[model samples]
Target: MIGARVRQFRTARGLTMSELADRAGVAKSYLSAIERDLQTNPSIQFIEKIANVLDVDINALLKDEAATNSSDETAALDEEWQKLIAEAMESGVSKEEFKDFLEYNKWKLKQK
Candidate 1:
């Protein structure tokens, strides 16, 4: 699933196998194998190379959907965040205000 997600993100970026290989400094054939799931267990270094090439977080490459939040939970969070953002926009909050809100939220979470 992680392999599939990485390939999806990579393709969405319009990167060919060889193009990504060049950007990641990895071999094209190994990258192909990784995409095809022929090699189920790629090393962390290899995964990091691919993630960097994709301009994505390494956590994105390593995510296990089964162990993470369910689609329903994520959807709920998305809906809530969207509502908050809409409200913020309607309130004419500046970008700086939004940045401050995000920072405050991060601090609040850390305290938790």
Candidate 2:
């Protein structure tokens, strides 16, 4: 999951693996391994290097879904949707309101 999150954030930032590896000062092969889940455990220093280049906190890189709040759940969104979600967050749209909107949309679709 950490591997997936790293890849997601890296891709969302429009970075290629080579680019990220170079920027993070880690080996491209190692980064690729991490992304592919071939390497399940990485050192803290390694994570810090990648996270710094990715512009996310170390905690964000390590957090499990159950530990996540509503905003943290947006990390998996595609780039366009991420932008929309960010905009909504910045506009102060509460999580409860978003949940209500989603439920309403589902109901509306069913009615149709």
Candidate with maximal TM-score: 2
| Alpha-carbon local distance difference test for all models | 0.76, 0.82
Candidate 1: which stretches are off by over 4 Å? 65-112
Clashing pairs in 2: none
- TM-scores across all candidates? 0.57, 0.62
RMSD of each: 8.5, 8.9
Error of 2 at 101 (Å): 25
* Model 2 deviation from native, Cα RMSD in Å: 8.9
lDDT tens digits, residue span 33-66, model 1: 8889888899999988888877678887788543
Lowest lDDT block of 10, candidate 1? 78-87
